[model samples]
Target: MAALWPLWGLSPGGSFWQRFAFWADALDPLLLLAPADEIRRSRLLLQNSGKTLSEPIQDDQMRKAFLLSLSSVHPDTDKIIPVLFRPPAFLPICLPLVIVSSLHLQAKATFFSQFVFHSYTTGFALINGNSTTKAEEYSVQEKQIFYSLGAISYAACIGAFPLVFMNRYTMKSPLMELIVRKLLPAPLLGLMSAFTVAVVRSPEFEHGIEVVDRNGKVVGVSQKAGEKAVRETALSRGVLFGTTFFLPNVLTYFVQRAKLAKTPRNLAVVRMLFTTLVLGGMLPASLSMFPQRGEIKRADLETEILSSTEEPVLFYNRGI
Candidate 1:
């Protein structure tokens, strides 16, 4: 699986479309249902083929195994990431949560919906981070719980805040209410999504993650690389949720103006369908925005790491 990373958009300098194509295939939900024995066999096939060349031989079986491994396993630790948290499960799980959260529901329902969405995303961010070598002191389950709860609370509050405010202080203008209730949530969700990633992965910023040379040798831990990884992931997440939440509403507004869906039920169905399409497209595009194995100039790293390696560039996993 590690050997196949570069071919799967972990390498540097692929066009966004190229990366998107890769993710579209790799994130297939069917791969999530593959049994343990199937995954193990796929890994074995790739490992055996990877020994002979830099790239695995292109074949149907090889492609299936590669996608299965990429979806199910973590690149940094070689451990199976939890089923719900894996990239393959991301769309199926998050799409509905996102749709439900974006709905014009009652305040309490909105809060609950946002809470569940953030909670799941928090777990996804935590499990997908490139923190395989996180400092031993930070390994306690309590710290993880604390971070998770803090992120979920923060996001849930932010997500439902607009609706809560409008409900308390009735707006005189329909335009103002529309702006407050509809337009505001997308950017807020986007911002809070990014925030959740930062809060959830705070330990990585504190303890640092392992950086590797061109040959994939771990030189040493660097706080700089960890910050870069988390920052990139956060930015990608912001683009994802922000666009996912914002675009559908804009389209819905235009649709309403044109009387595209006259009935409330029809409008609701159209909106949900739009949200689904936007999320499906944006998830891959956002994730493909940066190379999973990100590069940083050697000069920008710590003095000790610079002295230890002659390579001018270092790479680290920028988790999805």
Candidate 2:
């Protein structure tokens, strides 16, 4: 009675009718008949002083049978009423918007990928010199620069979403036309911004000083040591930044480009190639930097000293 009252929202007159209507509508689907059976059982119980139609059977067994019958029937109009007859309250309320908005993501990804392949990668190769001696040196340095710029570029591109929205709202035009017109430059901007940042930071590589011991002797050569440090930094930062911010935008670009191509074979090839180069490459590089990998998690000198001191504890006498 208490539970039923709450279900009725603490009122009897209006609540009773609402509750009755809800149940009737829920049962109206006829998909299941358990509700009708339960209603009949309730009526019989009221008329017969707590005795059910199956009164010859034990209460526990009869209750179990009733529950079994309820569970066995499929929900339908014939068996029961529909709850909230207009539409399912929860059948992906966002689905229509998603279908409508999918073009944006696709356009963004397409623009981003083109910018990366054509501009970012190519620009660096030219600036750093593509010859063998320069190539070997610059490959390592270029990766480090890429690590920093990738995240910033990706974020800036996504930040343009407000403009995309503005275009949609202001123009009394088809969404596809608005998208194509507004989003065409997304990839070029994303790639160029990332590339420019990488170039600016490249000079920072030469400025690091060498670490010295108490004796004033250089422990390691400055440039070599700096290279190692930078590599470690890049390993930790680069691929993650690229994958999270860069890859999705780039994928959107590639997908849109494929759509524009209008050739199924070309689209499939482009998608596979993009996935292989962007996502596939980024994953392994990111995983390689995990702190859990091998000796990367090893304790520093202070920790090692502390660990060494603990070895004597088990042998020490408490009495002393």
TM-score of every candidate: 0.92, 0.22
Look at candidate 2 and tell me the lDDT of residue 184.
Answer: 36
- Tell me the tens digit of each residue's lDDT in model 2 across 1-320: 11111111111112334433322232222423345566445333433433322233235544333323222221111122232211111112212211222223443654454334333332322232211122245664566557545544554355344455555576436675555434433343334434543343343235332222222222222333233333443343344334433454467466776676467666545544553455333333432342110111112212423343322211100000
Which numbered prediction scores highest in TM-score against the true structure? 1
What's the CA error at residue 217 for candidate 1, in Å?
A: 1.2
Model 2 ranges with Cα > 4 A deviation: 1-103, 106-160, 163-238, 241-265, 290-320
Reference-based lDDT, residue 243, model 1 = 97
Cα displacement (Å) at residue 138, model 1? 5.1
Compared with the true structure, the alpha-carbon lDDT of candidate 2 equals: 0.33
lDDT of 2 at 222: 31
